[model samples]
Target chain A: DAGVTQSPTHLIKTRGQHVTLRCSPISGHKSVSWYQQVLGQGPQFIFQYYEKEERGRGNFPDRFSARQFPNYSSELNVNALLLGDSALYLCASSADSFSYNSPLHFGNGTRLTVT
Target chain B: QQQVKQSPQSLIVQKGGISIINCAYENTAFDYFPWYQQFPGKGPALLIAIRPDVSEKKEGRFTISFNKSAKQFSLHIMDSQPGDSATYFCAAEDDKIIFGKGTRLHILP
Candidate 1:
């Protein structure tokens, strides 16, 4: 099966503008999570959606929000982009909540650049 | 309290050697521990993971050693090769996944 896929492989936007990122989970998977990986650092959890409901949210600001579709796809929206928002936005999917039997598979990621 | 601290920041080793990376977590609720490998321009891929109930788990040349009591774990790469070079991240998970800063491993051929 194809791995998790993310759209607009790369994006550029001005500070204070808004950006929307999209992700399609692997077939049969019902969970999708978003993370931000700043340069020289590991990924930080942003949000997680399961079965069209908000299952978990990270420490990100209100400007960062996400929603899941009936088909299990997801979109991450960031408002008032800051230069600090420049980083690789990653999307990972799991068959279910992460457990010993089920793990996360990630997409290449959408590189968001805020100038 | 949800941070997973990883070390060595970076490492360089000769081929056929052993590569080790260490991590410590402050969140006792983290029940699952996993290691991820990331190459430039790509997302991280899960390498191996272990539960708190086990002391060790191995797959091929990759091994995860967990010390539950100490809240620490480490990743061991046996017979390391140049292909093994990449940024490796250690993560702890419960309701959400938290990752370490990452360790850049460079294996010399």
Candidate 2:
């Protein structure tokens, strides 16, 4: 089975532009979460969706938004991107969101470079 | 506190030696702790995980020692090899995962 899949492996955008990154979770997975990792830093949580509903959100600004579809796919959108927004956006999936023991499976991630 | 603090931003160990990475968390509510290993240009993969109820857990050459009272946990890689060279992250789980800054481990051949 595929672990997790993400599209647009690498992206480049200008400041103040908008970008959307997509993710497809493993089959039979129902939860999808987003994280942002800057250079030389650990990934920071962005948003988590379970069963097509937003379950949790991190400290990101309003410019960042995400939604999960019925099929368990997800899309992360960033508007008015800034140079600071340049980072690796990762998508993770789990069997369920309520189980702490459920390990997360991650995708390779989309590398976004804002210039 | 919501942060998970990890130490030794980088480490160098000889082959057949042990590599240890430490982490401390301030949140007492965190029940699950996990370690992830990541290679360059790839996403992190779960290495090993432990819960507060257990003092220690081992898998293969990897081990996790957890101290609930001290809110500390560490990962021990036995007989470290060059193939184990990668970035390791310690994380605590609550509503979301709180990840440590990360530790870059290098094993000399």
Candidate 3:
């Protein structure tokens, strides 16, 4: 089975611009989550969608938003991007929303560079 | 309370030696603890994980030692190899997953 897949492996955007990153979860997975990893740092949770509903959110600003489709694919959008937004955006999928026993399968991530 | 603290920031070990990484958490509600390994330009992959109920769990050359009393945990790599050199992260799961800053490990051959 394929692992979690993300689109636009690399992207470059200018400050104040908007960018959208996509993710397709593994087959049979129901929950999708987004995370941002800055250089030399671990990933920080952004948003988590389970069954198309927002189940959890992180400390990110209003500029960051995400939604999951019926097929379990997800899109992460960042508005008014800033240099601080340059980082790798990762998508992870799990079998359920409430169970920590289910390990998360992650994508290689989309490398976003804000100029 | 959601934070997971990990250290040291980086490490270097000789091949055939053991590599150890430590992490501590303040959230007692976190029932699941996992360790992830990542290479450059790649997403983190689960190395090994343990539950609060178990004091230790081992898989092949990887082992997770959990200390529920002190809210601390550590990862041990046996017979470390150069290929094991990468960034490792320790995370705790509650309502969400919280990760540590990450440790960069380099095993010299």
Candidate 4:
């Protein structure tokens, strides 16, 4: 079975531009979450969606937004990207949002570079 | 406030030696602790996890040691090998998951 998958393995955008990263959850998974990992640092939670509903959000600014489709896929959109926004964007999926303890399976992640 | 803190920032160990990474969390609501391993150019994967109710959990050469009272936990890698070299992150989960800064572990032969 395939694990989580993400599109646009690597992207380079100029400052003040917008970017959208996509993610597909594993089969039968209903929960999807997004994280941002800066170089030499761990992944930080950004947003989480379950059953196409916004379940939780992190401390990120309004420029960062995400939505999950009915099919359980997710998209993370960042507006007016800054150089600091450059990082590896990760997408994780789980069986459900209530089972937070259930380990999250991650995709290869989209590497975004704001130039 | 940082909910979870991990150290050391980097570690170097000889092959077959034990490598230990420690983490402390501030939230009492955190009942689940998990350790993730991430290689260069890849996403973090679950290595092993432990609940506050258990003192320890082992899988192969990886082990998780949990301390409920002190709110501290650690990951111990025994008989480490070069392939084990990567960034290890410890996370605490309450309503949301909070991760540590991560430790870069290098096991040299």
**Each prediction's DockQ?**
0.88, 0.78, 0.77, 0.75
> lDDT, candidate 3, residue A73?
98
Error in Å for residue A50 of model 2: 0.4
Between prediction 2 and prediction 3, the one with superior TM-score is 2
lDDT of 1 by residue, B1-109 (tens): 4488999999999999999999999989999999999999999999999999999999999999999999999999999999999999999998889999999999999
lDDT of 3: 0.94
**lDDT tens digits by residue: candidate 2, B2-107:** 4899989999999999999999999899889999999999999999998899999999999999999998999999999999999999999888898999999999
Residue lDDT tens for model 1, A57-108: 9999999999999999999999999999999999999888664558899999
Model 4 alpha-carbon miss at residue B95, Å: 1.1
- Tens digits of per-residue lDDT, candidate 3, B1-109, equal 4389999999999999999999999989999999999999889998898889999999999999999999999999999999999999999988989999999999999
Off by over 4 Å in 2: none
Query: In model 2, what is chain B's TM-score?
Result: 0.98
- Over A4-28, each residue of candidate 3 has an lDDT whose tens digit, in order, gives 9999999999999999999999999
**i-RMS, every candidate?**
0.9, 1.3, 1.3, 1.5
What CAPRI class is candidate 4?
medium
